[model samples]
Target: MHFSSETRRDDGVVERDFTIGEIPGVLWTPEAAPTPVPLVLLGHPGGLRTMRPRLAARARSATRDGLAAATIELPGSGERPRGAKVDAVRAELRQALQTGEPVTPEIVDRLVLPLVEQAVPEWQTCLDALLELPEIGGPVGLSGGVISIGVRLAVVEPRIAAAVLFAGSFVPRVVLEEARRVTVPVHVLLQWDDEGNDRQVALDLFDALGSPEKSLYANLGGHTGVPAFAGEEAARFLARHLR
Candidate 1:
């Protein structure tokens, strides 16, 4: 929660870059917000630096809606060095894509499970620090993903009131089982023709969610072909639960 720099945006949102121990993160707060406003925890798709614009835009959207937003660099992303596990996973994924072979379940497990294990605790810790801030309050929401991490957080983090999950990633069986434990409200987005994802897996994972209140919005396109309106729809979903 130690901030190194702060910038004020034209939209009346203040962005701060910070570090909690070795983890780097950013927080965005709307100017003149009331004490203890709702908070949204964002998850990124790739390297945090590359995802900065998208994440910052999401923060601004949350801020404009009178909520605070925060996100952390996931393990082996951003400034963190890639450990052997992540390196192996990336190599395996690349090879599978290059060879036009469907990644085996065992390979998917190896690729995602360790990252899920490491990321969930880190997100919980980030949530702990975020809630401690005087300007943030209860009923947190989680948005974005590497899907498995979002599923795990929704299952274990009681503070998270809702989640907006992006369904463009694989789901290991163990993670699918854990998804059955999630009880928070969820809004899931699926790019129906995502080149790298298993469409059936995404559908099955959605089916596995234990949440009584969950909606799926599936569109016909590749991973990056999500329509603008879909994002707006997801934002509205978060607003409904968080605001």
Candidate 2:
């Protein structure tokens, strides 16, 4: 188990990478003045396009107000290459065994829904590494399309304290039906005029959430900017809950 850390930024965004467990993640902290900060873990969208600068910038901007954010590439994307991704993920299981920590997957069938099933295990693995980081001693929040639908399903565990979802369409009905069981506070951010399935999907889940603290926001933008919205809102939300 080796760990690597680095920082990068153009303009006001600051990006850093932490390699823990078998997965190496690019953690983004805003370049603003240092402050004791909350940790926000961002789940990138599935497919090649999700691993891009725009999403990184979104996560970085959230830290501007005083928060620590990081994004880990799932098995086959970002800096985590496909060949070694699975072995890296399995390494997490071995590490968990050594630490006596529990690691579980929310979604199991990614072929049908690349968002939840394919990436949920990766999310769980990333969370495990994050909890061990010196700078990340706070509640965790998650947001992503299809890939992050597992966040709500992950409610059986208490480690995750908060979450914000943006245009997720993985298990619309199941997630909505089970939304109330999630004890953690959640927020759904979306585009009011979305012309795709995500709009309706997020809306339905938002309606089903039993948590009084949960709410939904339909932004002016469309799908592409959802991560940006989640990043910004997550900062505020984390400050209130984790800080």
Candidate 3:
């Protein structure tokens, strides 16, 4: 909950760097909002520093839409300590990717399970801290990836009113099972041609989601080539729920 720096962007979004214990995070709010505003929790695949520009852009979009946005670094990513064991698993996954080796279920289990277990609680903790701020007092919505962590949060975090999930990440089968417990409205964005993602897994996971209001948006592109209209639709989805 301690902010290290604050900067007001040209577009009138106020950005702040913060830390809750060991987890580093960022929060963005409308520069002139007077009342409490809805909050959007921006999730990413980790590496907060590397991801900040894109994260901030999303935050600015939220603020422009009269919502607040925030994100925390996931376990074993960014500046936090990952220890030897987690580092070893990360190394294994990277090596497999570089060699064009199929990422086995075992390797995915090793790489993703620990992250879902640890990051979900950290997000909840960050939410607890962010809500204490006077400027952010409305409903919470989670928007972004890793899809596994988003699924867990949608299931367990009662405070989250909605979620906008980006498909095409390493989702373990266990998480797909957990998705059935998620009853809140969910909008999933799937990139049909993402080179690094498994299309079948994304489709299966989308089908596994138990939300009666869920919608899957499959676009033709690589990981970073999401069409602009796709993002606008996801924003609209959040606006509908949080409002």
lDDT of 1 at 228: 81
Worst 10 residues of 2 by lDDT: 104-113
Q: How high is each candidate's TM-score?
A: 0.97, 0.69, 0.96
Off by over 4 Å in 2: 1-5, 8-14, 18-22, 30-36, 47-50, 76-115, 147-150, 225-234
Model 2, position 185: C-alpha lDDT score: 75
Residue-wise C-alpha lDDT for candidate 2, range 29-131, written one tens digit per residue = 6555454356676655543244657656556555664667766666555555564545555466467557866433322222223434545666667667666
Candidate number with the higher lDDT (1 or 2): 1
Taken over the whole model, the C-alpha lDDT of each candidate is 0.88, 0.59, 0.90
Q: Candidate 1 at residue 148, lDDT?
A: 92
User: Over the stretch 39-112, how does candidate 3's per-residue lDDT look in tens digits?
Assistant: 99999988999998899878877887899999999888888887687789889999999999999888888888
Q: Candidate order by TM-score, highest to lowest? A: 1, 3, 2
Ranking by lDDT: 3, 1, 2
- For candidate 1, the clash count comes to 0
Least lDDT summed over 10 consecutive residues: which range in candidate 3? Answer: 168-177
Compared with the true structure, the alpha-carbon lDDT of candidate 3 equals 0.90
Instruction: Name the top TM-score candidate.
Output: 1
Give RMSD to native, each candidate: 1.1, 9.7, 1.3
Model 1, 1-243: lDDT tens per residue?
A: 799999998889989999988999999999888678899999986588999998988888788788899999999987887888779887988998899988888888988888989999999988899899888887899998699999988888888899999995577779889988999999999999998888888898899899999999999999878798998888889989998
Over 4 Å off in model 3, which ranges? none
RMSD value for candidate 3: 1.3
